[model samples]
Target: MATVTFIPAPAPDHTASLRAAVRYGVLGLIVLAVVGSIVATLLAGMPGLYGALLGAAVGGGFILCTALGVLFTAKLPATTAGAVLLGTWLLKMILAITVLAILKPLDFYDKTALVLVIVLSLVIVLGAETYGVLGVKAPYVEPRAAGDAEPGEKDAQ
Candidate 1:
């Protein structure tokens, strides 16, 4: 007869999903940016190329930054995380608005290309992030501990 030993699986890290999400989001944005740049270049030359690049940076960064903030704050308390997120959100909004306002008068980039890339990047990156997070396998229920009594039982004998 051969003796058998069972090895328990390592505990799952809760941050796995968040990390996966960020990775997918970054990859999606990069692909989208490259495609956008090529298409925009074909459509409007230098201006289109610039527009696509700028749009991708702005839109992708807007969402990616938030995910990163969340990941970084995962070890912190809920209240601290919330406060940091709120502050970051406000800063992003202000920065975005300021950037657009400054670029409003510039004719160096194609507005149509910029708008299209921004919209696409936002949607695609978000979808990719969602997919990544959902794909991660996480334990839904707590494992029973040795020596712990099951429900309805007074104590383990």
Candidate 2:
């Protein structure tokens, strides 16, 4: 007789959903980065290339950071997790503004290419994360009614 080993499945919970979302988000970012780089380069040469890279890093990284924050705080209390997520959101906004301000006067990168790639990255990554989150098979428990007989119990004769 052959011996068989079975691996336990992961729990269907917030962490599982988060892990899926993060995995898909990273995949989306990578795909966007590669395609954006190629397309931008063909459109505007080296400047376009630089723009696409910057856009992918800034846009994708911004959203990815939020997912990571939630994943990191999955085990914490609900209020604490919410607070951390809100804080991260604020920080991301500040960082985005600062980055845009710094890049405003610099002409080394193609602005149009940067904007397009940023928008595309945002849409694609967000869609991918949404898909991932929706794909998880979360377990559901049905509430038992009052006065229900115990499982496997027989009524008195």
Candidate 3:
């Protein structure tokens, strides 16, 4: 004789949702960078190409940093994603500062263009991330009691 029990499959992970969102964000950023570069070339001549390259690098770096976080946390529980995020963010900041300092000595690119691209890409990526996170279905919702009284309202005697 044998006993059988059925269990439902686990729902998708929050990290997976976030990863997808980030990928979309990165794609958007790349497209924006390319288009912006072409437009810049018309407006400002040579600085546009340099700015495009800088934007591409920044977008790529964001993907790499996010990938590292996901890869490192693959085997760990989802609860630790926050820590991974914080750590990777710190690393990104350090890397950004170092890259800026190194690039400063080489007066090849327009600083204004590079900075503008970076900032614009950052906004796009952040928006994508926010959209992704807000769309996620949280594991649990706060339970509400039936007929709960409003805050600062006393129960009837």
Can you tell me which runs of candidate 3 are displaced by over 4 Å? 1-10, 63-84, 136-157
Whole-model alpha-carbon lDDT for candidate 1: 0.93
Clashing pairs in 1: none
Off by over 4 Å in 2: 1-10, 140-157
For candidate 2, what's the RMSD? 5.5
Candidate 2 residue pairs in backbone clash: none
lDDT of 3 at 95: 86
Worst 10 residues of 3 by lDDT: 137-146
TM-score of each: 0.90, 0.82, 0.65
lDDT of 2 by residue, 49-110 (tens): 99999999999999999989989998899999999999999999999999989999999999
Better of 1 and 3 by lDDT: 1
lDDT of 1 by residue, 20-139 (tens): 999999999999999999999998999999999999999999999999999999989999999999999999999999999998999999999989999999998999999989999877
List clash counts for every candidate, in order.
0, 0, 0
